[model samples]
Structures are given as C-alpha cells and as structure tokens.
Target: MTSKIKGLKHIIYDLSRINEWWLISAGFVLFAFLPYTFMHHGRVLDIEMFRILFTDPAVYIALLIVFSAQIFLFASNDYFDRDVDALDPGKRVRNPVCDGRVTLAGVRALLIVTAIIPLIASLYFGLLAFLFSALAMFIFYYYTAPPLRFKNKVFLDVLSHGLFVNTFPYFFCLVALMDFTVGTVFLLFAIMMRSTMAQMLQEIRDYHIDSQVEKNTVVVLGQKRAIWVVFSVYIVLFTVTTCLMLSYELFGWGIPMYYSIILILAISYIPIFRKLLKAKDYNREIERLWMGQGRTNRWQVAQYFASFSIYFILVIFLIITGYS
Candidate 1:
C-alpha cells in the first residue's frame, strides 16, 4: 500500500509538468481573452465578465482539459523519446520513466488517463469543440508517437506544431466561448505563423545535437532554409499586423498607436534575420547566434501572446476609465 501511494504521487508529479503547463496556460489566457477584448473594446469593458469567468464551471473545465493535454503531451514526449533521451546523460537523469522512477505500464496508464479527460470535458463545449479537441489530441499524441510520427517530417513537422500547439488551442477556446469573425481568423494566422517560426528555431537549437548522433534521423529543414522561411513568415506577420489594425478596432485604438508597439517587437527580430541571411560562414554564425540569443525559441511565442494580453488589458483599463 505504501509503495502504491508513492507510485501514485510520482505519477501525479510527472504528469503535471507544471512549468510547461503554466507557460501554455498563459498562452491559453492570452488567446481566450482576445474575443473578450474585441467584443467590448469601444464599450465600457465589463468587470462582470471577470466575475462570471471566475465563477464559471466551464472555465475551470477548460483549464483542466488544457492541463491534461499538457501532461499527455510532455509525458508522452518523454516516453517516446526515452531511447533518445537515454542516450543523453542529462535527459536520462531527468526523465522519470527513463531513469526507472516510473515504469512503462505507469506511463501507459498516465497517458490513458490524461488523454481521456479532455475528450470527455470538451463535450460540454459542443460537438464542434469536441471534434476540435479530438483533432488537437490526435496531433499531440501522434507528433511523437509511432506510425506517422509527424515530428520527423520536415515541413509537415513545423506545420503540425503550429496547428496543434498554437492555433488550435486558441481557436477552440474562442469557439467555445464567443462569436468569431474574420479578425479572429487573422489572429489565428498570425499565431500560427509565429508558432511555426518558433518551432523552426527549436529545430535550429536541436540541430547540432541531432546531427552529432551517429545514426541521424533529423528531418528539420537545414538551418539555412529555415532562416529564410522564418524571414518569409516575418513578412506575413507584418501584413497581418497591418490588416488587424485596419480591419478591427483593437481595444478602441481608433488611432492605433498599438501598431507601433507591435512593430517594435517585430523589428527586434530583424537584426538577427539580416545577420543570418548575410553570414558568410553558416555553421559558425548559427552557433554564435543560438548561443547569444540566450532566450528559448518558445520565448518569442510567449512574448507575442503576452504583448497581446497586455494590449487587451490596457484597452480594458482605457475603456473602464473612459479614455477610449
């Protein structure tokens, strides 16, 4: 009985993956709040929505589904990458299953429990939300799982990552809660393009290690191509920013000084983009660039979401104060 209790404790902790859960939760909040901001921007933003959200069982349920999805994703990633991780000294020490702290059967049970809850909870949102949830879970599960593991397929790999990781989570939460429009689709497009760039950065970050492996299976597009792809996506993002400002009354920014803020963030990436494009020595430049950046590739993704969140909050404050 004591051993069973200990096993249960470990399973709970391992599956929580708390740091990643919180980070993704931040994205969820950012995405979920977008519709609220747009819908109430010119009008006095309601404090009542906050109260209702706090009291709403559905909000809690959605959060639980997201939490479960994170657990399933990261834990399953560890399980599927166990062999690869076991090859690395650091990862082998960190992975519970790989380190013998958890068994394969324990992992199987963890996967099943975590996977089922989201599908069940999503039903409360409606059949469309349920279908979206299923698709999200399927992509999450298969990204690293066997038989058409999408993680190893070059263009499809980053595309899938963008879809399941960024846009779908944002899309479903909005679909579950509010009426959406073309502006919403544009927001989703921006989110996806940024997500793909981040995943591309991850590919660049992991490329050296993956290439070092004796029998290489890395399908990340070569770093040179990825750099150009990121640049291309960067252009699309600028276009989206323009369209967003033109098409929507963002937070009652009738005169969108907010566009400047986005442009500031967008411009910061350009120095590196130009450097990578012009670099004469590819290998040395990439090593130096990745080493110098210091921030995680995913940091940029969170950064964008966070900026939008602040924009949302700022507008609400303005409206509440009659500044808008």
Candidate 2:
C-alpha cells in the first residue's frame, strides 16, 4: 500500500505543470470547438445549445487525448533532461525524477499509459484525427527521447517542437470539427510560427545551463542570435495572424464583429515588440524576463492573458449571447 501510494503521488506530482499544460488544454478546446461554434453559430439560439457543447462526449475525449499528450511532453522531457534539469534550481525541484519522487521505470510506465489513452480516445474522432494524434504522440515521445531526439538537434529542435507542441494539437482538433481547407492550412502556419518562437524563447531562457549540455538550436546560434530568431518568428506570426484576420473579415469567414478586438490586443504588444527588437542590452532584458521577480513576470502574464483571453471570453460570450 505504501509503495503504491508513493507511485501514485509521483505520477500526479509530475503532471502538476498546470501553469503550462492548462494553457495547452485551453488551446485544444478553442481550436477544436471554436470552428464548430462559428459554423453553427445560428444554433446558439438557446442556452442549452451552449450547454450541449460542454456536455458533448467529444469534448471529454479530446480533453483526454490532450491531457495524455501533456503528460507525455512533461514526463519525457523530465526523464531525458534529468541531468540538465538538475543544473537549474527551479527545474530541479519541480522534476519528479530528479527529486527522487519518481523512478526511471516508473516514468517509462507512465509514458506508456499516457500514450495508450490518447491512442484510444483519438480513434473515436476519425482515422485522420487518429493519425494526427499518433504523429503528435510520436513527436512528443521522440522530442526528448534518445536517438531521434528532436529537442537536441539544430533547427529540427524548434521545428519538431513547433509541430507537436502547438500545430499538431490545433490541427488534430481541426480535423474533428471542419473539413481541412486552405484557410485551415494558413491557420496551421501561424500556429507553427508561434510555437517555434515559444520553443526558441524557452531555449533562450535556459541558455545559461543548456549551453553546458544541451546543444539545441539556441545553444548553437548563441543566445543573442536566438533572441533575434524569436523576434523574427514573432514578426512572421504576427503578420500571418493579421492576414488571417483580414481574410476572415473580407471573405465572410463567420468571425464575429468583436474579432477586431483580438487584432487590437495583438497591437498592444508593440511595447514588448520594441523592447525585444530595439533593446540596447539583450542580456539584461532576457535576465529580467526569466530570472527577475518584478515587472518581467507580470509582463509575461499579461501577454499570456492577452493572447488567450479572446478565445476564453468569446466562448462565454457565444454561450450567453446565443441568438436565443
């Protein structure tokens, strides 16, 4: 009983990356279901329609698959990066394997179980979604695993992270809700660009220690150039998203009138835009972003909320303002 209790504790403990995994969960819900709401917007005539969205069996299945993906992402990363993680006080304390809260074989078993759940849940969607989930599972598994470890490779590091971390999940959800089209492809491109920026920024944040052992893309390019890469990717993402919004508006893609609010919010990031692109001292700015406990952290939180709140608030608004 005691051993089993400890095992359960470690499994639950390692999955406690709520600040992160929850964001991915939100992304899954928005990307998977938003198109459904838009296409069937007229169905919002009743509060029960909105309630049905939450109560639908598919939502639970997608949540199961996404949560499994997150478990694989964090656990595999921690299992493989245990040595590198031990170098950072923050990561070291949070890592179950490094902290001796989870065993190597136990993590392996956990990974197996997590993968199985996604495989089972995705089949309910369709063959295409199942395939998407499979590829996502493969990417998440091999991302930090040996031999084909995409996380340690130059360029491929960010590319693979871009695919599975964000693009794949969104695409997987897209497969379930809508017929794949050119518009969906464009959206995938925007997501991939944003994911690349995020992965590189994380690498930049860990440059101090990652440089020692993890020869990732950022380590190869060096932190200065890596930040530039992040900035450049952000520009591409911003441009693509702007174009997407424009297309939706012009082509009558069924987006709401308030969608312009999202563009305005994106514009609001101009201050950080100048901070990253026009900063006189990159080192100090990066340090404050990752290490400082002041405005930097608050800035990140603001960015997070700004980027995501539109989808979140829209979900509620759609539910309430249903043509009902």
Candidate 3:
C-alpha cells in the first residue's frame, strides 16, 4: 500500500507538470469557444446558448486536441533545446528536460501518446477542422524538430509561432461556424500580430543562449533592431484592432472600447519606454528584461490581463445590447 501510494503520488506530480495549472483549459474556453460564440452574436444570450456551447462533446474533444498539441510542442521544444536551456540560468528550474527530470525517452513517449486523440477528434470534427488540426500538428513538429527547427530561423520563427499557436487552432474552432466575415479576418490578423510580439519578447529573453547556440532569431540582428520591431508590431496590432472594431459598427461603444484598451496598454508600456530611453547600453537593458524584476515582464503580463478583459467585456456588451 505504501509503495502504491508513492507511485500514485509520483503520477499525480508528473501530471501537474503537463496540466500547467489548467491554463490550457481556460485558453481553449476563452480562445476557441469565444470566437465560435461570436457566430451567435445577435441571438438571445441565455442559459440554453451557454449550454449549447459548454455541453457539446465536440467542444470538449476539440479542447482536448488543442491542449494535446500545445503539450506536445512544449515537450518537444524542451527536448530539443535541453542543452541550451541547461546553459540558460533563468530557465533551469522551469525546464524539466534541462534538469534531467524528464528524459528524452519520456519526452518521445509523451509526444506519441498525445498525438493520438487529436487525430481522432479531427476526424470527428469534419474535413476542415481535420485539415487545420493536421497543419497545426505539422507546424508544431517542425517548429522544434531537428533539420527544420523553425524556431531557429529568423522571420520564420515568429511566423510559425503565430500561425501554429494562435491562428490555426483559432481557425479550427471558428471553421465549423463557416461565418467568415471581414471582422473575423481582421481579428485573426490582430491575434497573429499579438502572438508574434509575445514570441519576440521571449526570443529577447533567450538571446544570449540562442546566440551561443547559433540560432538566428530576430534578436540576433541586434537589441536596438529587435526593440524597434517590437514597437512596430504593437503599432500594427493596434491598427488591426481598430479596423476590427470599426467593422462591428458600434462607434458609440467601440470607439471608447478601442481607446480604453489602447490606454491600458500604453500605461503598461510606459515603464518599458522609460527603461529604453534611459538605457545607453543595449545589452544592459536586455539583461534587465531577462534577469531583473524589470518593467517589461510586468507590462507584458498586464497587457495579457488587459487584453483578455477587454475582449471579454466586448463580448458581454454585444450580448447585452445586440442580442435578441
């Protein structure tokens, strides 16, 4: 009984690592289902509609598939970059592969096991979902796998991260609705830009290790260039969001909504802007971002919270004002 209890405890601990506090649970709900819910925008917001969205077995299956893909990609990335991660002082505790907690064999087993259910779910969801799922899987694999580790490439890295992690799965969820609108396209582009910016920030944090490893990320171009690119990406993302809001034709609510969201982002970004302006040594600023309790991380997290809240509020407003 004692040995069995220990074994069970170990299993539970391992599962926790894979679960990631069930953020995937929240992500699939907010990201996958929320966009799908947009299809029912003009419909009455009530318990029945909520039930239809939440209670569907297909929805759960799709969530499982997307979650599996995310885990597989992360595990594979850890497996492939274990050496670099081992050298990265910042990532040691969080990286099981680098610390020898999760072996290559274990990672491979994880990858194989998680790939099965998504395929089954894809078949059930229909051809379009299946195709999107398959494409996402391909990108996820190539993003970290040898010979084609797209993450090591310059522009390709950000593009792959944006599409595989954000766009494709989003489309997989939204495809079933088949309600493609100009607004949908704009929103998708906005999401891609957002994802790219976040990915770029990560690349900045990993710059030294990546440089040692000969990985050619955008940061390799130099700190000043990378910083400028980050600024540019955010500007484009803001523009896209503005365009999306205009498409909704809710100037009264949408205009305020746009300025509010932008203001939140700007407030968060101010600290980083201060740091940048005062930072004479580019490397020092990068180190502060990566190693110190700098404003960049705080701002990034704030932006994440603000973005989710703004979108959630927008959905609620639409339901309250426009729903029949």
Best by TM-score: 2
Q: After superposition, how far is residue 119 of candidate 3 from its true place, in Å?
A: 1.6
Assess candidate 2 and give its TM-score to the true structure: 0.81
- 188-279 in candidate 3: lDDT tens per residue? 56557767776776776567667777566565677567767877877676665565456445543233342335445544565675676457
Ranking by TM-score: 2, 3, 1
Q: For model 3, what is the alpha-carbon lDDT of residue 159?
A: 85
Relative to the true structure, how large is the alpha-carbon lDDT of every model?
Answer: 0.68, 0.72, 0.63
lDDT of 2: 0.72
Global Cα lDDT for candidate 3: 0.63
Worst 10 residues of 1 by lDDT: 212-221
Error of 1 at 243 (Å): 4.1
lDDT by residue (1-324, candidate 2, tens digit) is: 999997887776655355555675766576557556644766443666667677778877777777777888888888998998899887787678998888898888888898899888888988878888888888888898899999889989998988767566677777766556655566566667767876887787777788888688988898778878787776676676677666666885633434444455456656765776666565466545533442136666777677667756775775667521
Candidate 1, TM-score vs. the true structure? 0.75
- What is candidate 3's TM-score against the reference? 0.78
Better of 2 and 3 by lDDT: 2
Model 3: residues with Cα > 4 Å off, grouped in runs: 1-25, 28-31, 34-42, 166-168, 247-324
List the candidate numbers ranked by lDDT, top first. Answer: 2, 1, 3
Candidate achieving higher TM-score, 1 or 3: 3
**TM-scores of the candidates in the order shown:** 0.75, 0.81, 0.78
